[model samples]
Target: MKKRVKQPTADVPALDDDGPFAGDRQFVGALYRGLEILRCFRPTDGPLGNQELSQRCGLPKPTVSRLTYTLSKLGYLVYLEDSGKYRIGVPVLGLGYACLGGLRIRDTAQPYMDELARHAGSGVLVGLGGRDDLSMIYVACARASSVVSLQLDVGSRISLARSSMGRAYLAGADEAERTSLLQQIRAKVGEEHWPRHEEEILRAIEQVRTRGFCTNIGEWQTEVNSVAVPLRTPRHEMPALAFNCGGPAYLLSRERLEQDLGPRLAEMARKIQTFGST
Candidate 1:
């Protein structure tokens, strides 16, 4: 007798769900599928063929072909004829840089991030979440030591479903906004991998809400840990930004993080938030 193999299931939710953009049929489905294709590229996959993309996105080969063609035509992706693969295109980089230029949060928070890095002897990052999206843009960073380096840089984009900074912001978001963002992330990354750390993530968010800070242990990057605190403007309607300090686990132990570094980060967040008012 042969052993059975469990087939993988579609991880995304049904488009008919009464969440996010509830009744917008064609627009939502196409948008979701297109984003699914682009997300197939990762830090590792240098470039990928239509076949690989199809397999990864769980879309038909013809659909992947059409989507890639449209993306190439729109300048969001480029095709390599010889190798028959595709990679992120130049226009996206230009747009990303342009967006970074417009964000003033980085300028306001740089000094605070620098102070945190200096005092804590760790790398610090300040980021702002996209208003209607489940992603965060790293606006500022200050590195204290050369031993540990986070691959992320200023202007780097990270998913809200997987990052401490993103989660802290989301945890602070209003009920309706948080639900919408969660729906979008699930629609994009699917349920399986998207919810890999659901319980832990929820707990982390609650802790952030309760303690006014958030900590992540080997969640986003293996062997690396981080702590973050939210920065809110005077109105306190949304988290205007967030700041975090991170490094190798050896240097970012829970005891030091809670006792020593947490207060410094909280103080920095307050100063950044206050500065944003002026």
Candidate 2:
């Protein structure tokens, strides 16, 4: 299994565009497989061979070969002639830049995100659920007072069902959208533990609706806790965004975070909403 210790260092995530289609009449199998191949390359996974791609994508070696060939020809995947492996290529970058350039959240939320980081002496970030991966990607960020292992930087991706940011995004999303997102998340959790996981996420969603924010305590990362609230801006596009503040669990205990920081986060979100509305 890939280690959860992986943390992003850069402000930009690895790619652009959206995730693969679920079940649609228009769903193209070839396109979905191509995307699956691209998804296989990660910051941790690095490059891959045909066999490994087959294993990760659950596709046959022959099919994988054909897809990789097509992708390589399209400049979406570059083949390493010597290593006999494939990695992401440049055209993917164009998609990411175009998507990111169209966003306004970072411009409006940045100053406040920084201030919250300083006030809480913890990392503060704003991100949205990716239409591409179902993960939330940080578009704006503020570092904590001290150096820490938590990797909440710009372009860093967080889980949809686990992180406070993710829960906030889910809570803010409309019913049809939230249901679709939850179905995707439930698949990721798998069958064995999904029942319990689903209940916990439902409670968090309720809390966000009633109490104004959500909390993450050693859920996504060990010994880390966070508070988050959903943000609603004008235009309010798909993959609705949210804000979160987090630090080591040692520094921000569960009780302290819920009692103190939680309200603060809700207030910050409201302020941002007001700021966006004007």
**lDDT per residue, candidate 2, 105-189, as tens digits?**
5676677766666767643333333434667777667765665636656657777788888888888888998898888877887
- The TM-score values for the models, in the order shown, are 0.75, 0.82
> CA lDDT of 164 in candidate 1?
74
User: Candidate 1's residue-wise lDDT over 1-278, tens digit each?
Assistant: 22111233365344344333667664566667777887777655688887899899787666677778778889888888767788998887787677667766667777766767777664443334443255676666787766556767665677576777777777767689778777777778777866665676687778787777788888878887777776667654334566677777877888877777777787777777776777
| Winning model by lDDT | 2
Reference-based lDDT, residue 88, model 2: 88
> Candidate 2, TM-score vs. the true structure?
0.82
Candidate 2's C-alpha runs over 4 A off are 1-25, 122-131, 234-238
Clashing pairs in 1: none
Candidate 1: regions farther than 4 A off: 1-22, 25-32, 122-137, 155-162, 180-198, 219-222, 234-240
Q: Candidate 1: minimum summed lDDT over ten consecutive residues — where?
A: 1-10
